[model samples]
Target chain A: MLIDQIKTIINGENVSIALFFIGMYGLCARRNILKTIISMSILQASLVLYFLSLSFHPLNVPPIGADLNAYAYVADPVPQALMITAVVVGISVTAVSLTMFVSMFHKYGTTNWNKVKKKRGEIE
Target chain B: MRRRVLAVLMCIVCFVVIIASNKVPTSDDLPIATYITKNAFAETGASNAVTATYLFYRYYDTLFEALMLLFSIIAVIYMSIHEGDKYDE
Candidate 1:
């Protein structure tokens, strides 16, 4: 019961943070270049989630009502707005990274990090 | 052995994150947020406070974001074009 209450009290940020670490692990531990790119996108998504979560409250309306005073609770709009740009940038970055990976796969003939390094004469 | 070590380290990092995130108060109570919510409709003539903030207060950031996307698109095109050329040869 105590643990459940604590879970209820835990901030939404905890979920985002966990996602971040999952992404980080994938980025560090994965060998495939595509998987690494996927991990990077996952990290970006977690950041977006964190920002969106920052704007939430238990019973808040969307910040779109004409009668501003009618609503006792409204979510923070700044984080929501900021995250829109972040999401766009994340998409752009992922697209570009994937394109680069395609180029690299063509050049090196392999997606595995160690194999690519060996083929390219890079020290691991 | 290396994976076990990394897993332990990751667990420690996750614990630190939980502790740090727990300390941050989870409430929408900032004074600036209050001001934005109250006056955004009047200042920007938009019912949506988030839209007003992005389109008016921080429009420059949005402009740069667009430019960044544009450049990335150009880069991808150029990179793929060279690959095509190499294939023809």
Candidate 2:
């Protein structure tokens, strides 16, 4: 029953929203840019999951070919399409964020957000 | 103190709005997964809907995404090496 309830909760929009909040919390609370980037990646994963779930139809088969009558379930293509873009974009964003983090680390010799802020303040 | 109170109030308002909007629908309310079944062959020649979705419909987007990843890596490398030179000098 709990599993069913959990599934039900996940089926709706709550999963994505939860992911967003969790990611935001991680990004906001964590002083390390790497951790923040990881959190953001989790957020992106949640979006991917949400979109993929949206495309699911009960008893659907892999959508392909002329034999539509043979299968009871047909997979949703839209989410699949969207997710491809999402996955790619996610990787790109992660890469960019990570690169920025590395640059910041090199410039300041630290990964702590507070320390970086202080260093910048000193420079100013 | 005022700013902290204001932030808390904003947080409360956001929480209330989110909770109010969090309505879950039953299975019957869900959209019919017909698009993949109908357009699988035309859009993506593959039989697997997942594959078609990634390869055919969003191939260009995927490529650009990969490029973005590459660009980021290059940027990181460039920055690190550039900074290393400053220390060496």
Clashing pairs in 1: none
lDDT of 2 by residue, A1-124 (tens): 9999767655445666666666766765667878888988988997887777764666766566665647666666667776777887778677767777777786899988878989999644
Q: Give the Cα-based TM-score of candidate 2 against the true structure.
A: 0.70
lDDT of each: 0.82, 0.68
lDDT of 2 by residue, B1-89 (tens): 66545645554566457755766643652243466566666665666766765666567766777777787677656655663365543
- lDDT (Cα, 0-100) at B42 in candidate 2: 61
lDDT of 1 at A72: 87
Q: Which pairs clash in model 2?
A: A59-A73, A60-A73, A60-A74, A61-A73, A61-A74
Chain B TM, per prediction: 0.69, 0.58
DockQ, 0 to 1 scale, candidate 2 = 0.37
